[model samples]
Target chain A: MKTPWNRFDFLLLPLLGGAFILLLWHLSSHSWSGDLPDPAKTWHESKPYVLEPWAKRGELDQGILRFTFLSLILVAKGYAIALILGTPIGFFLGLSPTFNKAFDPIIQILRPVSPLAWLPLGMVLFAKIKGINVTEVAALFTIALCSMWPTVLNTAVGVRAIPTDYLNVARVLKLSRWKTLTKVMIPATLPYMFTGFRLSLGIAWLVIVAAEMLTGRPGVGGFLWQQYNALVYEQIILCILTIGGVGFILDRLMSVIERRFKTI
Target chain B: MSAHLELFNLTKVYPSKKGPQTIVRDFNLQIPKGEFVSIIGHSGCGKSTVLMMVAGLTTVTSGGIILAGRELSGPGPDRGIVFQSPSLLPWMTARENVMLGINQVFFTATEQERAQIAEYYLSVVGLADFMDKRPAELSQGMRQRVGIARAFALKPKMLLLDEPFGMLDSLTRYELQQVLIDLWRRNQITTVMVTHDVDEALYLSDRVVCMTDGPEAGIGEILNVPLPRPRDRKAILELPEYHRLRATLIEFLEVRAHHRPNSSNSPSGAATPPASVPVSA
Candidate 1:
C-alpha cells in the first residue's frame, strides 16, 4: 500500500508536465511555417495582448473588456436564476417519489436538447418584447434553461439518497417536517447538491458562450466571432485566454465556498 | 391514578406474501410512574416489537397503548425513544444534537435555559469535552452517550429503549449501564428497555419479564428482582438467590426452545427439565 508518491510528488508532477509539453511543441514546429507560432512565440506574441491592458490601466481594448464583463454578468445572473428555481424543484422531486416519477421523463427529454437549439426560439420570443433587450435576455435564458437540469436532477437525487434511518430518527424525535428538512435532510444531501451546483455552473458557462455566439451579442463569444471574421488572430487568442482564465477562477471560487461549508 | 405506561392486550402483525405473521399478541403490561422495567428474551422473541408498539412507532394490530391514561395514536414528544443504533445527525456537533429538540419542543425556554439544560445533560452523560465534536469524530461509546444525553434533555414522560446498549462493547456497556442507573435513580423517570442479555435485565430492572417466541409471543415468566439498591455485578453474582434465578431462567428458555409445533400436527419434542425441586417465585 505504501507507494512512492506523496504531496511533493503531485506538486512537482505538474511543473515537469508543462516543461515536457513545451519541449514537444518546440520540436514539432521547428520545420513548420512561421505563420503557425510555437508555444514560446505564441506566449511572446500574446503577452502584449494579455498584459498591456493591466499595465497601462485605462480600459485597453474596449471591445474585449466590454464583452468579457458582459459575458460574466450574464453567466452569474443565469446561474443565480438556476440556483433559485432548481433548488426547490430538486427538493420536491427528491422528497416525493410521486413528483419525481411525474417529472423524471420530462426532465430527461429536455436535459439532452442542445443549448444551441434554444437560440432561435429565445430570439423569436424576446423580439416583440420592447423593454428587455433580446440578445442579453436570450443569452441569459439559454444559460438558465441548460443549467437548471443538473441542479434539479442532482438535488432530487440527493434528497432521495438520504438514509431511511435518519428520517426515522427525525420522525421519532417528533421534529416538524420543516425542521427535519432544514436540519436533517438538507445537510445530508449537501455534498450531492454541491456536485450538481458545480456541474450546472459549468453548463451555464458553456451555454452562455454558445448563446452569445448564436445571438451575435456584445459578449466574449461575440467578440471572438468578430475577431475571427476580421482575421484578427491575436485578438481572438486574447479573448479565448480571458474566457478560460475567468471560467477557471470562477470554478475555483465556487469549490472554495463548497469546501468551507462541507464540515459534515 | 394514572398509569405511567400501559399496554392492554396489544398485538402486532406483518402482512406477508402468504398471510399475516404475528409478532406479539395479547401483550398486557403496566409500568407505574418512576418504575424501571427491563424485558429479556431470546432473539426473534418480539422484544423490540413490544417496545416499538409502546413508543407508537409501530401500529398495534389489536388493543391499545396508554400513556398516563391517554391512548397513543402515533409518535409524540411525551415518549422519548433511544434506539440500539446511535442515529445522531452526522452533520451536527454533540451540542447541536442535544439542542435540536430543546429548541422546538420547549420554545418557552430562554437561550440561557436551553444552553444550561444541554450542558447539564452533557455533563450527566460525561460528554462535556466532546460537546463540540461531531458524531464521526467521537468513538462509538461517545456517540451513544450523546444520544442518551439528547434523550434525557427531552424530559419525556417515559423512555422506551430498544436494545439501546446492544451495539456497545462489554466494558462500554457496563459503564453506560451505570450511567443509566444513576440517571434513573436521580430523576425517577419511567423506563422500559428491551434486552437480550440476562445480566443486563437483572442489574438494571426492578422487574424482569421473560418473553417466549412465536406467532403469539407473550410473557412466559415475570421475575420481581429483590436485589438491593445500588447492586454491583460482582457482589450480586455471589448471592445464592441470583444463581438460583439464573438457573431457573436458563431452564425455562431451554424448554421453550424445543416446544415448536411440527408439520405432523403433533406436539414437538419437549425440553423438559429433570424432576428437581422447583423454586417458588
Candidate 2:
C-alpha cells in the first residue's frame, strides 16, 4: 500500500540507513576490528580507483567502475539467453500439461542449486570448446544456468493464471488458434513473463559474483577475491560495495520494466 | 415459419464422487428465425446450461443442436453471448475489447474498417464517449454495455443471453433492457435468453419456456406472448392479454414451479407440466 511510505521517505530513509551503517563501520574499525578499514580510511585507500574510474592499467588492475561494468555485461548476456530460452519453455510448461510433467522434475532439481555448484559443471561443459576462452564461457554458462529458473517458472505460472473468462471469450468469438494465442494468451502472460525476467536478472547479478570468482574472469567478484588474497582489505571492501551498488541498480532497472508490463 | 434453431433431447450428466449427477435431461426446443425465446427457471436449475449447450460452450452429453440447417458443435462466432456480469478484459479499452472479437470475425476487413466496426457497435450500445476508456475506468453498467456490444458486433447468427442483466440494479437493468430490445429489434437475430425474472422474460421473449426444478431439470411449460413487436412495458400492461400472460407466468413461478415433490428422483413426474401446452396457457 501507499501507506508504507512516500517517495521522499523511500529516498531519505535509505540515506539514513547508509549513515547508520557507516557510523557502525567507523566505530568497529577503531575498536575490536583493527584490521578492517573505517569508512574514511577505506575511501582514502581506494581514492585512486574512485577518482579515476576509467583507468585500465592491466588485466586485473582496472578501476572499480570497469570491473562493475564487466560484471553487468556478463550478467546481461546470460539474462538475455535465459529470457529467450526460459520464456518459451515457460509457455510450453504453462500451456501443455504434458510438457509441464516432463520437465518439472528436472526444473525442481536444478532450481535450488548454487551458482558455486554450477560453475564447476559449466567448466566441464565448456572445456572442450576450441578457440574460446573456456573460463569466461564457463562463467557465462553458470550465470545462465542459475538465473533461468525464475523466468521459466514465472512464465508458466502466468500462463496458468490467465482468466477463464477471457479464454471463454476467445472460444465463443471463434478466434483462430494463432490469434487466440497472440492476442489473448501472449498479452495476458506478458506481465508474468516480466516478473520472471526481473527475478532472473536478480539471480544473474547474484550469480555473476560467484561465477567470476570461481572462473577467474576479471569482474568485480574476481577483484574482490584477488584483493582478499593480496591482503588489500580496503580494495576488498571497495569491490564488495561496488557489487552491492551494481546489484541494487540492476534490481531497480528490472522492477521498472516489470511495472511497465504488469498493466497487461 | 420454418425452424431456424432446434435442440433435440439435449442432456448433460456430470460424474461426481457421490455418483453421476444429471443436471439437464431430454431438453428440446425449436425456434423460427428472428424469434426471441426465454428459458425461465429457479437458480441452479440448469437454464444457463441449456443456453450454453446451444452456444456450443458446453459439451452435449447426448443430443444435437441444428441451426439454419447446419448441425453445429463447439463454440464459434456464429453464436455470441452476453453474460450476467461484465466480462470485459480490464486491461483493454472498451473499443479494444470489442475489437478483439471484431478482428477475429471480420478478419478479411481492413484494420480501419475493423476500428470503425468496433466504434459503430460501441456507439450503438451508448458507449461512444467511453469506448476508449478501460473497463476499470467505466461504471458497472458501462462495462456490461461493452460486453453486449462485443456480442452483437460479431454479427452472430444466434445471440445467447445468459441473465445478461441479473447483476444490475433496477434502474440500470431497465435502461439496459431498453438498449438490448432496441438492438434486437433492428436485426431480429434468432435469440435465446436464460433468465429467472418473469418480467424480463415477458418483456423480452416472444415465447417463454419455464423449467421444472433441477437435479435433472426438464422443460415444464411454454407460454407464448402474442404482443406485437416494438412493445412498450406500460402499453403492454394496459392490455388484458398482457396481464393474463403475466399472471400465468408469475403464478407458475410462485406456486407451481417450486411445488415439486419427487422431481429429483423421477426426473419428469407429476411435478413437471406436459411439454406441449395450449397457446393460452
What's model 2's lDDT at B275? 41
Judging by TM-score against the true structure, name the best candidate: 2
Query: Measured with DockQ on alpha carbons, how good is candidate 1?
Result: 0.44
Give the Å shift of residue B187 in candidate 2.
0.4
* lDDT (Cα, tens digit) per residue for candidate 1, span A1-264: 556676577788898997998787677667664444577666775666455443332323344555677788889999999999999999999888899899989999989988888877888888999898887887777888899988998889889989876887777778887888888999988987887898899889878778877877667787677667766555665677778887888789878877866776
For candidate 1, the TM-score of chain A alone relative to the native chain A? 0.82
Question: Which residue pairs in model 2 clash with each other?
Answer: none
Calculate candidate 1's fnat.
0.61
In model 1, the runs with Cα more than 4 Å from the true position are A1-12, A19-37, A54-67, A234-242, B1-3, B214-216, B251-281
Proportion of native contacts present in model 2: 0.79
Model 1 docking tier (incorrect/acceptable/medium/high): acceptable
Q: What does each candidate score in C-alpha RMSD?
A: 5.4, 4.4
lDDT (Cα, 0-100) at B188 in candidate 1:
87
- Candidate 2 versus truth, CA RMSD in Å, comes to 4.4
